[model samples]
Target: MLTPMLASLLPLLLLCRISFCQYSSDQCSWKGSGLTHEGHTRDVEQVYLRCSQGSLEWLYPTGAIIVNLRPNTISPVAARLSVCIKPSTDSSGTNIYLDRNGKLRLLLREQDQAQGKVHCFSIQEGALFIEAIPHMDIRRRITAFQYELVSDRLRVEAESLSAPCQPCSNTDMLLAVCTSDFVARGSIKKVDQEEDHSSVTVELSRLYRQKIQVFVSGGVRVRSWTGHINMPLQCGVRSGEGEFLFTGTVRFGEAWMGCAPRYKDFLRLYHEAQLQGNNPCQVDTD
Candidate 1:
């Protein structure tokens, strides 16, 4: 004998289990479509399905054709385009279209046609999904865009644009030590500025590498290019009464600061080099 509440919950639990098993065994397949713009006609081919264990499937349209030239049959200024989806009994088959607002929509229909080509489109949704390559006017200038589909989700990523070029900082501690002419722990005594350059005087406390004559008590001037010239320093040494690790070259009577490592970071790198039986001063090209 079953209670009324238990009998009511039994049907719902069985329905959930059946749905889960169906999704686990289901495989994705693409439905083909014909795209026509002006007089140019191309067939969009179906691709393989990608599915994970107990996850939603993905149907990819890998053979979607891209036509560059517009036909003379249509107007040169504005060309009309149409996409006709092949009829199928599968409920997963969807008609992909671009609304007037340039948004992608997945509708359950036998066929769909549009006026213009869309930037993105999908052939199916839910358990099975397919996204066409984005074809925007501005995409011509992009170098590359990465596309990925996982568990019925589509992701598109574009490479960063380049303008106003800047130099990248050197992150390798051992490489910074090998390329530098002088490495020491010092305190900034004064900062002097000119029309196009600035100089900072530092009092040395400890010397790690001595390419030139450096005194512990004497002041050392470090020159840096400023103003219009863009020589951005990676580690800035302020004119306060604190000790800092300095790495740079000494030319004439001034030291050109290229890198300034923190005390703890410098010590960690120094010990790591020693434990590996490698010299920090020697450059490792490999």
Candidate 2:
């Protein structure tokens, strides 16, 4: 009892479903490329890596996410170098990335910034390879970072250090590198936070600092806290910790402190509010 026209559109509709499925799983593996485990200098190399999902399921519905070391077999088992997949293709035509423990990791879309679009995709095509940048300092070093299209290619880069010279004992070396890549679009996101005189803080923190996707949905409301005149901000609840995490400084009533109009735009804040609404925004730590 199926009409020819309806049947013809089935495949297209199915593909669309696969393309928009919002998925996440907690799982990771070692995806680095170095032999030395000496955490002395900027030459430090990661034996393992962690990743989240970042693409829509299209033709295959499922794709393989590989996380191998830069020079496979150079580091030790404790270094932990591997990759994992949730096999979304098997279930929904999309292969979701997972951690070693089989947990879900979230991949984020890059926002507009000084570094440009760190994580954004147009056509959703091809495999991506990322590079590594040495850390500026050991204390404030970048443990891991996602990559984006520099000009022509997608890249992921890790920041670590090598062993320092004899003169510097505890100082880190600027040699080792951390890098990870998966199939699909390449990108990154930065952690942005806002604070006020009353100690009101809005922090956007993620498991992986580089992979935060920005999504916008209809009916999302945003506002600012500091009440600036320019790009005011909007306030919202974080999903996990239930904290006040403002997006861009938009306008709250009148001040341009921060604002996020849509739920998806403020997904992180919504997530936090859902889980920790009971906790006062002034005292919560997470």
Candidate 3:
């Protein structure tokens, strides 16, 4: 009872439906690092092991476990992630010490049915950035701290958008991007000079709303200067056997401020001690 025209249209409609589904799935997979699809209904097996998700296997110095997966359908997707752990918590707290190189590995395998697609996605990938960590070694009552310097500093940024099609008049658009930089440095120290003449310097520069805060006491003193043009600021602390000096220079847009009250008190104490010929160096944990 069916007409030839209707029969022909049925196949075309089915094909269009399949194409739509395929396109939707492909778009979703773009947000993921790895995606595998099985044209059939059989299960698929695969292995994944690495430090962080979305990480390339060859780049990992430490190996991970071989994973055997039974994807519910035919193909399955998986991603390896790489993460860096720091031995020290904060720049002021951690001793920069490096051990023969440290590394870690992890493995993940799917236990359920493996006939479908395996999707390897990472929510944290777009936010990944490099950070500094302090390395330290302690023996008996003595301690030494060292800073591990990272040569490469990378930052990630992302944005989202939504819009509707229109012929005229009505229009709307919204966009935002987040950015951050890794602070890489080779050395950081604080001490007083008496028998050895040493000096320290610290500097920082940012937008008008940004400000740098420094804390000093006893044998420590600080000095600062501002520049006319926008530039990165710098601060440093130097120590010797008899005295210690802290200086900071801020460079930014034409308008800037260089006065920090609490830091001035520290410098005052250091200089006052020098005028009195007294060693202002005192070791105290705060």
Candidate 4:
């Protein structure tokens, strides 16, 4: 809610002096308590975080916080970076906004934070303004979310994880194999359709790389990997398929399909690129 009070509140929050900040040299993540300013409910604090990806947690939120997010790497690409935040499922107690200069734009209401949806904005937009929603009993209140700086130009609006309806080009596929969060050889074991997306279970024969522990390795004797990838429902992806090379990005702890082609096709393309000395990166297909 853009109450008239917010207009006045914005300036106060923005101009607030640096107080007891929960920052570190690396400053990737921040965890603090609004109880620190418990007596001053109208007080404000500015938090600076420099990282490509990180999280913030505010316990017992009382006053307000201005979260300034910036990428650690300083370059022209920083201007093009999109800051995406996924609210914690249990997050509550504060309203979030985009604060540009003294102007405020609502990003998320306190209640909406419970839905745990992802939100994106350009780095040039503004710092995040999170104001505590006044409540008598702030004992059980907390506001938290994970943020990521997405720089992929292919992702028109920062939803870069999910592939579109059309298959990726040979060149994109090659790049994805090299740059994706996870690269694996697998087949669709199950496909569970959802309202907005489809969850595909991949029975992986080999997991060459993973940015995180998305795939689990079975016991030593069993020797296997299994993981799930989300895809756009319109892709019409099904369970039946030959072996495929799966390469995709991970967003908010979930894998999303990217450039995936049949294993044979990828082998052929890789071999051709290798002979031409044009492969972006090498994969040990052997």
Candidate 5:
């Protein structure tokens, strides 16, 4: 009872629907020889592994599981190094390592799935050797933690070995500004000459708000500019020449210099303060 044109169109529509469903599933498979850790030769066989739905369900849209076939040879100095399954969509994936003690540590991008199967490769004397792990269930072995959107990319914390997980908090510029007494742009002049003291002079380029002062017991008072602030010294801002963004107690004269920010970060914080209808320089009473 159907027209010829209508019948032909129906078949095409069904095919299109099937293709759409496949794409939406986000299913992935591995397409290369397995990882090689001990030799320079590549395995000739191509292995295909399906992504586990149980693992992919837990990750952010950008999260993925990594199966480190050999964790010991990941170091730069190691003669035989292997890397497989690098995510193509995101070049900013964090490098995680399994230490000898079985503790998984993040190698880059502290703090924070394309469910895909990646082929592992071993490098020897400048030649790439494929390493293979047969019938590996990667999803069950790796654990992901703290998957959150960080800027344009999803920041994820994950471990390769099956073990207990520790949580990490997400701290951004706005959170830092809201928690501190004041935020400003400044530069470190020099480390003070006092013995056994961790003090530095900061030349304030711009103060977001006026400085504050506080008094303690015994009628003693401290200034915020005296470097009583507890900023991490290892932030590499100690060279004392380049400009930086600082946040700390203005009254106590202690300031911690964080890294420099883009112009948009300062603008974003400025607008955030406007939304709250409160002064950004207001001191914390608690």
Candidate 6:
């Protein structure tokens, strides 16, 4: 009762329909369940996420899912981008892996998800392959994480573990001003020591440039700006320290200290460079 052509087309059409129902397109965040066909299908679905940052949640684990994350706009750093994922403290039910051409490398195991640690890999490494860990009861299991795409320059030794703590040379200071996310003349007002890093409160006398308004303007009365930046505890940054020419990177909406030097030292270096016409960029030192 059926022609050969119709029978072959039937399977293809059904596959397309199933795929459409499985994933959302062009989404920055994704939320879905692992329940599948016949309630035991162990099917693998493809998820496409286009954004620099987002979150994913999967409930009722059963099968697997491949998450494809790529930038929406092409940029020079696109090729150098890395993916960072912070697993939720309670996330479970799946083992995460990297999938390239079907070859898989484990990224996270099920038991480790509860640790809520952040993991990173290059974008070129592959899509995220999250496979459900087999369990009899699928009722209470879920996997969730927040992800961010960042350039290599922006993705340094996070939490100040390997963050550069040495004083920037005269040349590096000049260059940092030209390329850093924020530059200002400031002083440490308070330093809160943490296990691995120190949180520094800064009062900026002059803000040269900033990627965003991370520093709150003190207005006419206060006549300056104030903000916070994190530094490696080993840096020994302390409150009441003398003024500094501050520079650093802002990651995930938080500022991280970079090549900060004594304001007096920077003034001397800057003046010498200006006299020599070797300064990378002009700054109003007044």
Question: Highest lDDT, which number?
Answer: 4
Number of backbone clashes in candidate 1? 0
A best-first ranking of the candidates according to their TM-score comes to: 4, 6, 1, 5, 2, 3
Q: Against the true structure, what is each candidate's TM-score?
A: 0.30, 0.19, 0.14, 0.86, 0.25, 0.78
Candidate 5: where is the Cα deviation over 4 Å? 1-171, 192-197, 214-236, 250-253, 256-286
**Per-residue accuracy of model 5 over 1-286 as CA lDDT, tens digit each:** 3324323334443353345311213223322111321221211221122231111111211112233122222354443433333232232222333222222333322121233212223323121112112222433222222111111111121112112222212234445455545565556666543322245566554455434542121223522232333333333225444665555433113333322454355556556665777444442311
After the best TM-score superposition of candidate 4, give how far the Cα of residue 283 lies from its true spot, in angstroms. Answer: 2.3
Query: Which whole-number lDDT from 0 to 100 does residue 222 have in model 1?
Result: 42
Ranking by lDDT: 4, 6, 1, 5, 2, 3
Each prediction's number of clashing residue pairs: 0, 90, 66, 0, 18, 0
Judged by whole-model lDDT over C-alpha atoms, candidate 5 comes out at 0.32
lDDT of each: 0.35, 0.24, 0.21, 0.82, 0.32, 0.78
lDDT of 1 at 112: 30
Which residue segments of model 6 deviate by more than 4 Å? 1-21, 35-41, 59-62, 74-77, 111-118, 135-142, 157-164, 219-221
lDDT of 6 by residue, 145-235 (tens): 9888977755554433345477677788999999988999989898998766799999999999898788999887887999999887778
For model 5 the local lDDT of residue 32 reads 17
Q: Ten consecutive residues with minimal summed lDDT in candidate 5?
A: 146-155
Error of 3 at 6 (Å): 61
Clashing pairs in 4: none
Highest TM-score, which number?
4
Write candidate 1's Cα lDDT for 1-286 as tens digits.
3324323433443353345311112233222332321211112322233321111222322212211111123343222222212222231222333222222244322223222111222222212112233332322111111112211111110011111223224344556576655766766777666433345666665666755554333334643211111111332324786666666544322355655656566666666767787654653222
Candidate 4's residue-wise lDDT over 52-98, tens digit each? 88999989887788899998778998888888898998999889999
